[model samples]
Target: MAYTISDACVSCGACLDSCPVDAIKEGNPYTIEDTCIDCGSCEDTCPAGAISAG
Candidate 1:
């Protein structure tokens, strides 16, 4: 499954540059697209703990 950003996201933009597949979109919580490869990079970069496997 792909990783998703939750409501806890602070829009800190931490996960933006971390996505190797470039599947994450800009927003409040941010949006992970289907192109996500589940690399867990964004999950680790998210400071708000908003990212998780969906």
Candidate 2:
């Protein structure tokens, strides 16, 4: 499963820099591509508790 960003995201762009696979985008919730490695790095850095495994 890939990690996803929820509507609670603040779009602060913190998860973008934490993703090792470059899966995160620069939108409201940000986007995680299917190519995601499922690493929790992004989740750990999310301020809004938006990143999760799906």
Candidate 3:
């Protein structure tokens, strides 16, 4: 499974660089691409707690 970004995301770009595989993309609430490795890096770095296991 991969991580999904929720509406709670603040678009702060906190989870951007945290993605080891560069699966996270910049957007309104940010997005996780299919390349996600499910490492939970983005989720851990999300300040708004918007990322979760999908």
Candidate 4:
């Protein structure tokens, strides 16, 4: 499964820099693209616990 950033995201930008594939976009809640490698890097870096496998 791929990882997704939820509404709980704080727009902290933590996950943005952690994505190796640059799949995360900045917004109220970051969005992960289909190109995501599902490496869990963003999930591990999210400070708000807003990222999860979907």
Best by TM-score: 4
Clashes of each: 0, 0, 0, 0
Residue 24 lDDT in candidate 3: 84
- Minimum summed lDDT over a 10-residue window in model 3 is located at 13-22
Residue 3, candidate 4: C-alpha displacement in angstroms = 1.1
Candidate 4 TM-score over all chains jointly: 0.93
What ranking emerges by lDDT with the best candidate at the front? 4, 1, 3, 2
Tens digits of per-residue lDDT, candidate 1, 1-54, equal: 868789998998889899888999998768999899889999998889999987
A best-first ranking of the candidates according to their TM-score comes to 4, 3, 1, 2
**Ten-residue region with minimum lDDT total, candidate 2:** 27-36
- Once superposed on the true structure, which residue ranges of model 4 sit more than 4 Å away at CA? none
RMSD to the true structure for each prediction, in A, is 0.9, 1.0, 0.8, 0.7
TM-score of 3: 0.91
How many Å off is the CA of 34 in candidate 3?
Answer: 0.4
Q: What is candidate 1's local distance difference test score?
A: 0.89
Evaluate candidate 3 by giving its C-alpha RMSD to the native, one decimal: 0.8
lDDT of 4: 0.89
Candidate 3: list runs displaced more than 4 Å: none
Judged by whole-model lDDT over C-alpha atoms, candidate 2 comes out at 0.84
**Which of the two candidates, 1 or 3, achieves a greater lDDT against the reference?**
1
